[model samples]
Structures are given as structure tokens and as C-alpha cells.
Target chain A: MVKINGKEHEAAGKTIAQLVLDGGYKPERVAVELNLDIVPKAKYNDTVVKDGDSVEIVGFVGGG
Target chain B: MIPSKEEMFAALAERHGTDMQKKLSEASVAVCGLGGLGSNISIALARAGVGRLHIIDFDKVDISNLNRQQYFPDQLGIPKTEALEQTLSRIAPYCHITADTVKLTPDNIPSMLKDEKFICEAFDKADQKAMLVNTVLETYPDKYIVAGSGMAGTFSANLIHTRRVAGRFYLCGDEVNGVAEGEGLFASRVLVCAAHQAHMIIRLISGETEC
Candidate 1:
């Protein structure tokens, strides 16, 4: 199981883009950080998760 | 009589110990984006007696900004840096501030923050915030950057969190919310997030870096 936002999940063979959708975040609204480096929006479909790989998903808020 | 610069700064930092006071007085911070977060963060830092503040922003004050930004009605139509400098000087006379009315990008960030060990990223857009954070991490690997995200709308105030996202990067906000089309921004929530950045800068400069 791979970790998404610090929680374990079974996401074998799925691309980061798919994981972002599965996690209920809109593709355009969210930013994905695989391991430590940020995954550019263009590469979301190309990047995949491995077991124990940490992921962090964050979004922008309105106002300041 | 108004005290001298040194005397005023000392008075402002009087309650905090010598170490903290000295650290604050000697520290220089670059506060980017003088919007809601930048406005509050810079003012907070000034009140805390940070020595030199490099306030950068290129936008002019608009009426729409009154909802959550720290500008008054009389200051509308003026550049953010100018208005912020005027306000900061009135309230926090001891703070030595350099207001640069220039649009900051990944390229200018290094020069803007060259002498700063602490940076407060207060941009309004996610892309801008991400750009600044990424550039800073790549360039100023040793400097600490305090950024806020997911601070929009009027929701669970407790959800706003300040956590260390990387070795030298700290993030503050709910971490899940965004600017939904109809979602409204609460002034208090925005300021709550701003306070996190301000407090983090203070704590970091004071040698209390753990939390």
C-alpha cells in the first residue's frame, strides 16, 4: 500500500493523476508532491506511486 | 519626545528576553505580496520589532480588497507598497522597512531575499505561492520560508494548521480548502492564517525553531 497524505492505501499501477481523482481532488485545483519534490501538472499522468512512497496533496485557498 | 530608533525598538521588544529581543532586532525578513496575508504578516512583524523588512508588491489597492485586506478607504487607488509603508510607519515606527513596488518572480526572489534568513510568502494565487516556494527551496536551501495556503472561506477555524512541510519550509492553513466559485472569504480566517506566518517568523528568529 502506498501512502497518500500520510494514510496508507492500495494504489498499485495507478498514475498520480488517477490517485488525485480517487482522493476527491480536482486535477486543476490540487498540487501533488510525490515524496518531497513537486510533480508538475504535466507529469501527473506519467508519475506513479510505489509502495511506502509518501504523497502530499495541497490546494490553494482564496483571499490572502 | 519620540524615542530614537534604537530606543523605540528596545521598548517594543522589552517583554521578550534579551536573546529573543536581540534576534528580532537584528533579523531582516522579506515579506512578498502585500495583500491580505502580506499586510497582516508585515504589520505583525513590525510590531514584533523585526529590524529591516523588505516589503515587495506591484499591485495597487482596489476597492474589492477592502473585504479582507488591511487597507483603509482613503488609501484606495495607491500602490500597496506605498500604502503599507505609510501604515506601518504610523503604527510601528521602529521597523526599518524598504517597500519595493516591483513585481516579484522566481528570478528576482533571490536578490529580494538575499540578506534574509526568513521569508514570508503571502501571494494571492496558488501558482505564485508554489513558484516562490519552489524557487526559494532550490535557491535558498538554508533559509526558512513560512507560507500559508487553504486559508479561504469561513469554515472551521481550528482546521487552520501550521506545520513544517519540509526541512526549511513551513506551511499554515486548512490544507484542503480552495477558492470555490461561491465560497466566501472570512477576514478573521485570513488573519488567523497570517498570524501563523508572523508567529513562525518570530519563533524562528528567537531560536525557538522546534514548533
Candidate 2:
């Protein structure tokens, strides 16, 4: 089980990028934080999800 | 004749406790927007005796800004950075203010705000706020980010809060209200969140863990 934005989900043996896309967030639109560190945009696919891993996906909003 | 700095900050120093006054006199915080949240938050911070403020914005003060932003009728059509400078200077003559006119992007936000340990993200847009938060947290883990969200409608004042969203991020707002509600941004509610951010900065500056 992996935690996405603090919610538990089954994502074992999946790359961070794949899980992110499956979660309905576009690769280009959201920032991905795996565990405690950010997974740079270029390295999203290489980073895989494991049990107990935490992921935070935050999208950008229009600025004032 | 040049007036002494001590005399300029006399009353301000008296208002702040001795220890907090010393720290406030030496602390600097970056305000990332100059609209409703930025304008109000900047004024609150300046009046609170924060030693220095670096305010950045590229938009001019439109007539619409008068509704919720902190500015007088005479400030319409002037750049927000310039307008805010005028207001802050009057609030605290000794408070150092650097007003920069530039469009802040994710790539450049970190550079422009790199020097400040405490950062206030007061953008009207959620994307800009999120980008700034992610970039700053990733690059400068040591710094603190005071961000706002969802302070749009004239809702219950009790809904507004300063929540520690992350280890170094204190988000102040109702968190879901926006222009979509059709109520629009009101000054009183907006200031509630802005003051929350300002107070959080003061708390962090005075070496407190709670906000």
C-alpha cells in the first residue's frame, strides 16, 4: 500500500509517474513529492512506489 | 538634518516587547504578491514593526483593486509595488522596504526570495501559490512559507485559521472558498487571513513553534 496525498492506495510495483497519471493528475500539471523529497519532473518515471511510501501531488492555481 | 533611527522606531519599539522588538528590528520577510492579500498583509506586517519588507508585484492598482486591496483612491493606476512602498514608508519611516516590479515565475521566485528566511505567499491564483510553495520548500528547506487560500466569500470569521500544512509551511485561509462562490472577496474576511499570515510571521520571527 502507498499513500497518495495522505490517502492509502494500492500501488506496489508502480512508478511514481504511472501512479500519478492513474490518480488523474497530468505529468505536467502537478508537482510530485515522494516521501519527504520532491521527484524532479525529469525523473518521475525512474522513481517507483513501494509499501509505506508517501506521495503528495499538488496542482498550480492562478496567481493574483 | 538626519533623524536618528532610534527616535524613528521609538513608538514601534515600545509596542513590541523588548526581546521581540530587537528580533523584529533585524528580521526581513518577502511578500510575494501585491493585490488584496499582499496589500493588506504588507500593511499589517509593516505596522507590526517588521524591520524590512521586500514586496514584489507587476500589476498596476486598478479601480477594481480598491474594493478589497489596501490602498487609497488616489493610488489608482499606479504600480502596486510603488503604491505599497508609499504606504509602508508612512507607516514606519525606519522600516526598510524594497519594492520590485517584476513578473514572478516559478523559476525566478526562488532567486528573488532566496535571501528571506520568512516568505509570505499572497498570490490571488492557486497555481502561483502552489508553485511558489513547492519551489521554496524544495530549494530552501530552512525557510518558512506563510500562504493563503480560500478567503473569498463573506463567510463566518471562525472558519479562517492558520494551519501548519507542512513542517515549514503555515497556510492561512478558509481553504475552499473562491470567486466561484459568487460572493467575491470582501475586505474584512480577506484581512482576517492576511492578518493570520502576518501574525504567523511574527510568531516565527519571535522564535515560537506554534502559530
Candidate 3:
């Protein structure tokens, strides 16, 4: 299991792209951080989340 | 007649307490993107007697922005930095406001934000917000960044609050409501999130970082 936003999730080996999709977040509207490091949008499809990884996905909106 | 600087300072000190007012008067902050969030946040900080502000934005005041942003009908077509500076000067005559009308990027952010220790991320687009947050996190390790997000729709104001994301980063808003979700951005909801950001900044300036 992996930790997403401090919660335990059954997503040990999923890519960041898959995690965002599973979480129902628009791929373009969210920013991901893995273990305190930012994951670029272009690299989300290739970067995978390990069992102990902690992810923070911050979804953004257009309005200020 | 406008109050003298000493009178204004005394009034603020009376309202905020002498110690907190001193900290606020000595503090400096940078606000990027003078939109609904940034404009309102800047106004709140100014009214609270923040000593200096570095305001940055490339856009101008458009008519549509009147729906939620803090701009007057007569100020349309002017650069946001200039308009906000004019407004702030009237609100807090002793407050120092430095404005730059340039589009911020990962390249220019470091140089532009070098002076202020506290940064407020108030950009409108999702990608731009991410870019600013990511750049600040990777570049300025010591400075604090307060960002706004998910403040859209007619959701309850109670949800629009602050969360400490990292050691020096704070996120404020509902965290779920978004204009991209087919909901609208109303003045009340947007100002609620902006108030949270302004309050968090005030707390940070007062050394109350734990939240």
C-alpha cells in the first residue's frame, strides 16, 4: 500500500498518472509531489509510486 | 482629511495590540497575480498595517473582472500592478508598495521574489499555480508560500479554510470546488478564500505558524 495525502491507499505500484485518474482528478488540473519532490506533468505517466511513497496531489481551479 | 502616519500607526496598534502591530508594521510580503485572490489579500494585508508589499502581475483590469476582483469600474484597461498600487496607497498611506508589470515564469520568479520572505501564490490558471509553487519549493527553501485553490462555486464558506501543506507552504480553500468543475466563481466564495490566505499570512507574520 502507498500513502496519498497521509492516508493509506491500495496503490503500491501504480504510476502517478494512474493514481490521478483513479482519484478522479483532471490530469491537467492537479500537481503531484512524491516524497517532498515535485513530479512534473510530463513525467507523471512514467513515474511510478512505490509501496511506501507519500504523494500529495493538489488539484487547482481556474478562478483566482 | 487623510490621517497622519503616526495617527494611522497608533490606530492599528490599538486594534491589533502593540506587539502584533509592531511585527506587522515591520513585515514585508510579495503578492503574485493581482486577481480576485491577490487583490483582496493585498487589501486585507494593507489594512492590517503590513509595512511593505511587492505586487506583481502582467494582466490589466478588464470589465469582466468586476464580478469578483477588487477593481473599480473606472480602473479598467490599466495594468493590475499599477491599479492595485494606486488602491493600496489610498487605503494605507504609510504602506510601501513596489509593483512590477511583468509576466512571471520559473526563470524570472527567483529574481523577482528574492526580496520578500513571504510569498502569496494567487495565479488563476492551474498550470501557473503549480509552476509557481514548484519553483518556490525547489528554489527558495527558507521562504514561506501561501497559495489559494478550489475556491469556486456556491459551496459553504466553512470549507474555505487554511491547511499547512509543508513546513513553509500553506494552502487555503475548499480543496474540491473548482471553476473547472462547471461551477461559477462568485465574489463571496472567492473573497472567503482570499481572507483565509490573508489571515494565514498574518499568523505567519505574528510567528503563529503552527496550524
B77: Cα error in model 1, Å: 1.0
Candidate 3: the clashing residue pairs are: none
Alpha-carbon TM-score of each model against the true structure? 0.86, 0.87, 0.91
Specify the highest-lDDT model's number.
3
Q: List the residue pairs that clash in candidate 1.
A: none
Q: How many clashes show up per model?
A: 0, 8, 0
Q: Which stretches of candidate 3 lie over 4 Å from their true place?
A: A13-28, A36-49
lDDT tens digits by residue: candidate 1, A1-64: 8888788889867898899888776665555678876676668899988888888876554447
Candidate 3 chain B lDDT trough over 10 residues, lowest sum: B174-183
The candidate, 1 or 3, that scores higher on TM-score is: 3
Please give the lDDT score at residue A24 for candidate 3.
Answer: 87
Write model 1 residue lDDT over B147-207, tens digit each, in one string: 8888877789899989877567788888766664556667799899999999999989977
State the fraction of real interface contacts model 2 keeps.
0.26
Report lDDT per candidate. 0.82, 0.81, 0.89
Candidate 2: segments with Cα more than 4 A from true spot = A13-32, A38-46, A58-64, B1-4, B180-183
